[model samples]
Every structure is written in C-alpha cells, then in structure tokens.
Target: MTTSVSEKVYRRGPFPVKFRCLEVLRVTPITPHVVRITLGGEDIQGFHSEGADDHVKVLFPEAGKQRPVIPTMGPTGPVLQPGEKKPDSRDYTPRRFDPVAGELDLDFVLHGSGPASSWAAQAKPGDMLGVGGPRGSLFVSNDFDWYLLAGDETAIPAIARRLEELPEGARAIVFIEVADASEEQKFSTRANMTLKWLHRDGAEAGSTDLLNQSIRTLDFPPGDYFAWVSGESLAMRPIRDYLLNERGTNKSWVRVTGYWKRGHADHVHDSKN
Candidate 1:
C-alpha cells in the first residue's frame, strides 16, 4: 500500500486552554529595567508553548489577595466564576519553557505602574501567580534565507527566544530600542547575528521613530526573509506600511504587532497583514 504525503505545516495549536497557579521560584534582573521571573510547580507539568511568540494571560491577584481568581474551564472556554470580581490580567510572552524541569520564564518590562510591572517588581520566591491560555502557536518555518527582528523592550522576550531557537549558521539582523545603554541585553545564540541597540536617552518610549529610521537606513541582504516588528501601536503602523508597501515584502512573511499602545492600559494589538 502507498501512503500520500502532505506539505509541511508551520502553525499548530488552539490547544485546550487551562489555567495553572504556580509559585515563583526565582526572580532575576536581566537589565536595569527588565525582570525575569521564573515560575514552577507541579502545576506546570504539562504547560505547553510551542511558538517563539506564544503568550499567556498572566493573572494577577486583586489587592490584598494572595492568589488571583482563576477562571474555571467551561465547555467552550474559560469562564469566570459567578459573582467573583475579575482578576487583573495582562498578556505576556512566555520567554522560555522547560517541560522536563517544569519551569516557565516570563520577562516583564518594569515601566510605569501597571499591574504586571508592579507585580513583577516585588515578586519574590514562594509567591503565587496565575497563567492561562497560550491558545495557539504560529511556528514560522526556518527555511527563509534570513530573518529581521525589530522592536522595543517589550518585544525583547519574543525576539530573544527566536534568536536562541535558530539553528547554527542562520542569519538574523536585530534592532532593539531601549531607554539607554543600561537597558541593553546580551543573548547567547549560535546563529550569525548583527544587532543594533538604539537608545532613547531620557526621551519618551513611544515618542520616537528610532525603529523606523534605523530600518529605513538598512541595506537588506539578498534573499527571502521573515520580518517581525513590534512595539508601541502607533510606532508599528509606519514600519508595517513600509515593509508591505514600499519594500514589497510578502504580506504573509511579515508580522507586525503592537505590544502596547500609548495612553491605553492593557492594550495589545496585532496588525492585519
């Protein structure tokens, strides 16, 4: 008997959504403004995150509470318990996940007084936090000749994960904007990478066009490549337009995400490609 073969598929999941209450195992400062909180417990045994940019809705406890109110899994999806006040939650990239060790790492940008930042700032060992639903993962194929990554601090976690996951000899060009030299981070990757760090130097986070300007000056290398651009919502628009309209990049090969929007709390936007 002969079997038919199918083309390789790059995307997976819409996995069952489940909430886990895990304990903070450690907290490390990656940079002056970025914190890495490692969470682990038996509850994380089967936690799944297959994409470099997979995100979990990090649930935070209400004031004076020790643990957040996690939603009960419903027939169709998660449903909040009746009459319970909703918990504060924010979407965060799962920077790393080690299933064997049952550990998950989440990097938080300590900017402003938002719930996630505030929670991460003071998080200590043994503290409990909740995480839910990476819903799905988009696994980009590594067949591209090169890769382009550009964003602000909020995008670092996802970008770093992608870099680390690239096989040796892969080529990647990275542009990251941070507060200053003090906010820059170093990564260990086998891929051939050229990185540029842009400093705001006391300027506002979303007020500059540093990412767009730097990209404009780039002399892109020859070959098909995947491009990932993310950061402030308004800042992402022009960059997306340039890549899609001016450069004539394949729409399906480019992803533009607004990790946050100025003046809007808990805002997350994924621009339509």
Candidate 2:
C-alpha cells in the first residue's frame, strides 16, 4: 500500500474505545432490509477504526421519547434494572467515515425484535443518538501470505472495509452469508477479493447450517494463510477447531469472534476457551 495524502486514514486499527453523543444527519435505505444512517457531531472528529472483525456500540433514544433515560452512573456500570426506562443500545459497523467533515456513516440491519433494528426501521431525520468505537483492532499482517474471511451480515461492514484497505495484490477469499439472494450487495475494493455471498433462504442470522456447509467444503491450498470468522458465537466452535487444530493456523493470524449468541443480547466473549 503506497502512501497518499487523500487516501490516508487515522484509525490505528479498529477499537477506538470511547463513547460520544452524535446526531443523525440523514438516513438512506440501501435495500429493503439495509438502512444506512449518516451521523454528525463535533465528538465524531476524533474517531478512528480499522474495520476488520470489529464493531461499535450505538446508543439509541428511548422507544417512545427523544431522550433516553440511562443513568450516567450505575452500581455496575451503565446498566439499569429489568423493565428500566432506558434507551436501547445496538451494535453496528462503521460503513464510512469523514473525520475532516465531522461525519460518520453506520449501516443498520432493519430486522424485527432488536431495539436497534426496530429503531432503524422507523428512524427519521433529526434523530439524536450516542456513538462510540475505535476500541482497538484485531490485526492480521500480510504475514499469512493468503487469507480467508467469512461472516454474516453483522460482519459485512468490517469485511468490506478490510477488503478496501488490503494491499492491491493481496490474495484473499471472503464469504458473506445472508438471508436470501435479494439481500446480497457488492463490496467495492482494490484487492484481489473473491466474494461469495451465501443465502440461506429461510434461515435465521445465527444459525450454523449454511456457515458450516460453507466452511467444511473450502479447498485449502498450500500456503501460510490466515482466517477471520465471526457471527453466532456458538457456531464458531467447529470453525475455530478446523483452523486452529486441523489447518495448524497461527493464533496471531486468525481472529474468530462470536459476535452474538443464540439466546443472549449485548453479548461478548471473555476467554477464548
């Protein structure tokens, strides 16, 4: 990757690790289920993200009101009791950023049930919300030589960002699993990327049927390559073993995150075990 003033990025590599209130400047529906929102605020000027297997938290306004009721302080952290009158929070990927112009774009999956998804479904102009990220990044150097990237829609933004930032001649295979063919979208990039969008006609987001089939059939060539996989936390188990035990992948080169679990909300992974 050559240096160019116009193509420079400040995000050290994903996780920025700070929270700020940003106002919604605009929202555009890219598809029937994918909505993109443009946010602006002075606080956004300092954000930087690597956008590879990374995500950010989006604090939403109350369901029935403009302002949320989450307390700045809590017994544990920033949480309230059940049935609390706090605004909902969702995780999303930074689709785009323009630090110089004080603008950041976040794309949302307008699925039902989830607070962030429902809010984005009905979100309108002049809405205000809190945005935070740059928590830090998971890095995989060109050391592997080749790479394999796979995940669900929640992983698409980061996957696309990585593709665009990869070295021009980098050899990589990317698989984005989606609900149906209609949900598919092209990811623009300069790297030699082979993007395969897999659609599970009636499958849910966290299911492993399609993801498992896809990973099991992959043809691993002879080379020191790496893999990055995320999505349903539970489903990643088999793939983790395949890469770590079967393929003999380097721990440093593979980043497999269980972004979400089947029965939990605001989920995360503590220890790799």
Candidate 2 local Cα displacement, residue 171, angstroms: 1.0
Top candidate, metric TM-score: 1
As for candidate 1, its clashing pairs are none
**Candidate 1 lDDT by residue in tens digits, 1-273:** 212121212456668888999999999999888999999998897899888888899999877777888888889777887798888888999999999888999999999688989999999999889999788876777767899999999999899999998999899999999999999999978899999999999999999999999998999999988999889999999999999999998777888899889998879657676
* lDDT, candidate 2, 85-173, per-residue tens: 65667667788877778788888887777888877887777777776565555555653466788988777777877777788788888
Can you tell me which runs of candidate 2 are displaced by over 4 Å?
1-17, 69-86, 269-273
TM-score of each prediction = 0.94, 0.84
Sequence-dependent TM-score of model 1: 0.94
